[model samples]
Target chain A: MREKLIEFRNVSFRYGEEEPWVLKDVSFDIYKNEWVAIIGHNGSGKSTIAKLMNGLLFPQEGEIYINGQVVNQDTIWDIRKEVGMVFQNPDNQFVGTTVQDDVAFGMENRGIPRDEMIRRIDESLTAVGMQDYRLTEPHRLSGGQKQRVAIASVLAISPQVLILDEATAMLDPKGRLEIMSTVSNVQDRNELSLITITHDLREVVQAERVIVMNEGVIWDEAKPREIFAKKDRLREIGLDVPFIATLADELNKSGLRISNEPLNHEELLEDLWTLHSKM
Target chain B: MDITFKNVDYIYQENSPFAHKAIENLSFHIPSGSFVAVIGHTGSGKSTLIQHLNGLIRPSNGEVHIGDFRLTNDDKPKNMKELRSRVGVVFQYPEHQLFEETVAKDIAFGPENFGVYKRDIEKRIKEIIPAVGLSEELLERSPFELSGGQMRRVAIAGVLAIKPEILVLDEPTAGLDPRGQKEIMEMFYDLHQKENLTTVLVTHSMEDAVKYADHVIILNKGTKYMEGKPEEVLTQQEALNKVQLDVPEMIEFLYAFEKRFGLPIPFKRQSVKQLADEIQHAMKEAGSHE
Candidate 1:
């Protein structure tokens, strides 16, 4: 059986009494070594889940358990050690002048010994493919490079669950791909429970499972392919699907007999090739 | 107004130790009332180029011409107020600049500063609120009270209240969701058409560049890398890839399909249904010939 890494039970949260609940009775469990994408439109409470997980905010009505430990203030510190979150703005998260210093900042805060911190800084930067840029200043790096450094800093803590809260939202397409591939590499090398909170469908395509958030509630939970197949409903909730999925849906509507719902370009091409061969 | 940059260069902190050449020898002509999209990776000088469109920053080496107005290396335009009224710029994350008590006051800020009549400012606010797809009920609320997407619309409305002949947008839809992005882009395109404005869009989205722009310009490392019609410039995938750029998804799909099937499928900005029809026809013809 897969181990449960984090669980939110009967969670309901709001910023203040005047404000409406942002997340209402939301319950979900993240399993060990699995990738889950939390997707929603803005103001949809997708990001609240990330904050709740790391103990930045406690739910008003419910409890969040990290590895079976209740996430109250006393246990919050321990929960943070296991859950390292990379937030949306790359510029805001950067706390060091140089790349190496930035990677070491987290460990320094935790009072890790200098020798071990130095070792981890090297290992984590190498994992993100940013080893060559170790001495570069934060301002000199690209948005994608800075985000990777943020990932490296998180990895320095050796967390079991790494939460990327719209980490690639501010990056260009090339940068987005870099973060996605870097995350894939880190997951390959470590036993990580990765939760990516984003509205980006391209990122969602890579996730093993998707959690759809709409209007402060969990709308649906399914595999990425299953989520993409609900293209119209996804759009109705103010989200989009990848190009291939949309194209497949369009072709199917136009009387093209596609046997399966293709998720990406390669699969779509293969389906087209099969149709062409039969013709 | 038509814009021309003749061998322009801009150096930030030119004489100091922190001196950096932000743009170099950048020369381009934007004809009056044309929609031009400028695209490049971060630090590729896209921001520096747009600053020249208005008189935000004067060129360090050469001349920038906005119709009859000229901005040269040694001289600042005396009529900067007049030039600014004609060119409205919506900067990235424009909502952050909003500080007014009400949306009406915020949108009216631009025109009021330009000496528009008080009555006329109110009229412009009424007209612009709808143009940006925000209901008039939002006009009384503080901009800070609005959602992120709504605040962005309010900021765009502020720029539009000036009724600029030249609309220069620096990624107006940067942080919006998909529906919000589509809505904002469509609003800008409609404004571009109805007002006959010369629009300059600096963005990171190749998809938006292909869908809306008549012409596209690519900047690389403080220099003009390429400029042409959108279809022509975007289909050159290898060249774009060299600069760490991507073609629009439609064009990319076609390119990949051609390579995989050994069929020469020309790239076109068409709906998926149309593409499907063309692919089916191609398959029929190829099968019959075989």
Candidate 2:
């Protein structure tokens, strides 16, 4: 049986008493060593969930549990050690001048030994493929590279959960792909649980499960293929299905008997080829 | 106003240790009232090229013509205010520039400075509020109190309030969600048509470039790599691959499907239904031959 790494029970939150609820009775569980993608339109209470996870914001109602331990003011600092978040703006999170110094910043705050900090700085940078630019300043690096450095800093803390809150939103297509692949490799190599809050469907294709949010609620939860199956509804809720999924849906609608929903281009082509050979 | 670049070269911080050539021998023309997209990887001189549109940066060498105004190395446009009023630029993350207490005042700030009468400024705000997809109720709220997406629209509305002939947008939808991205791009498209505004979009999204732009310019290493209609320029895979640029998703899918099935499928920016019908027709023809 898989262990639950994080759990949200009947969680509801609002900015203030007068403000409307940002999250309404939301509940979800992230399994250990699993990759979960949380997607929704902006102002759908996605980023708020990220903050609540790390105790940056406390739940106005309900309970959030990390490894079966309830999170509150007393346990916030302890919970933070287990959850390391890389936010949207890389420049905003970076506190150090050079890449190495930034990666070491988190560890230095916790008063890790000098030799240990140096070791983790090297290891985490290599994991994100940013080892060569350890001495380079943050401004000199590209947006994608700076984000990878941010990821490295998060990794240096050795957190159990890594929350990337739209971390790839500001990057170009190539840069977005770079961060995705790097995170995938790091997740596999390190066995870290990843919660990627994003609107990008391509990133969702790689995740084990997807949680759809809308109107400050958990709209639906399913595997990537299942999520893509609801193409019209997804678009209605302001999210886009992957290009291949849309293509498959189109082909199916055109009287083609596609045996199953194809998640990628190769799968779609395979389905077509099977039909073509039979024809 | 139509814009032209004549062998323009831009060097940042000339004669300093950090000096670098941001653009080199770049030359392109943007016709009046036409929608053009500038695409390239980061630091490929895309930003440097767009900065010349509205006098943000003068060329280090060569000349740029924005309608009647001419900009060169030694001489700058004398009427900088008039030049700015003619060309409105929405820089990346435009919300970062919003500082007014209320949305209406923020939108009015630009036109008010350009000598728009107080009464006209109010009229312009009322007109542009809905154009950027914001309700009239938002005009009274503080810009800081609005959500990030709403703040972005307010900022864009501020620029549109200027009523410029040409609008230059630098990744205006950079950090917005999918729906926000679509709404903003669609709003710009409508403005480009209904208002007959000359729109120049600097973006990283190939999908947006393929969908909206009449002309696409690809920049590489401080130079013009390719310039043509979106259909012609984006279909050539090898050329885009050489510069590490990505083709739009639809084109990439068509390419991969053709390679796998050995079927030649023409690429065009078509609706999903149209593409599905074409593929079905092709498949039926192949089946009958078999």
State which candidate has the highest DockQ: 2
DockQ of candidate 1, scored on C-alphas against the true complex (2 decimals): 0.70
The per-prediction i-RMS, to one decimal, reads 1.4, 1.2
- Give the CAPRI class of candidate 2: medium
lDDT (tens digit, per residue) of candidate 1 on A90-150: 8999999999999999999899999999899999999999999989999999899999999
lDDT of 2 by residue, A1-279 (tens): 999999999999999999999999999999999999999998898999999998999989999999888899999888988999998887788899899999988998899999999999999999999999989988999989999999999999999999999999888888899999999999999969999999888899889999999988999999998888999999999998888888787788899888678888788888888998888
Note the Cα lDDT for every prediction shown.
0.91, 0.92
Tens digits of per-residue lDDT, candidate 2, B81-161, equal: 899998999999999999999999999999989999999899888899888999999888999999999999999999999
Name the runs in model 2 displaced over 4 angstroms.
none
Q: Chain A vs. true chain A, TM-score per candidate?
A: 0.98, 0.98
Give the C-alpha lDDT of model 1. Answer: 0.91
Q: For model 1 chain A, where is the 10-residue window of minimal lDDT?
A: A250-259
Residue B5 C-alpha lDDT in model 1: 93
Query: Which residue pairs of candidate 1 clash?
Result: none
Residue A188, candidate 2: alpha-carbon lDDT: 93
Compute the DockQ of candidate 2: 0.78
Query: Chain A in model 1: its TM-score?
Result: 0.98
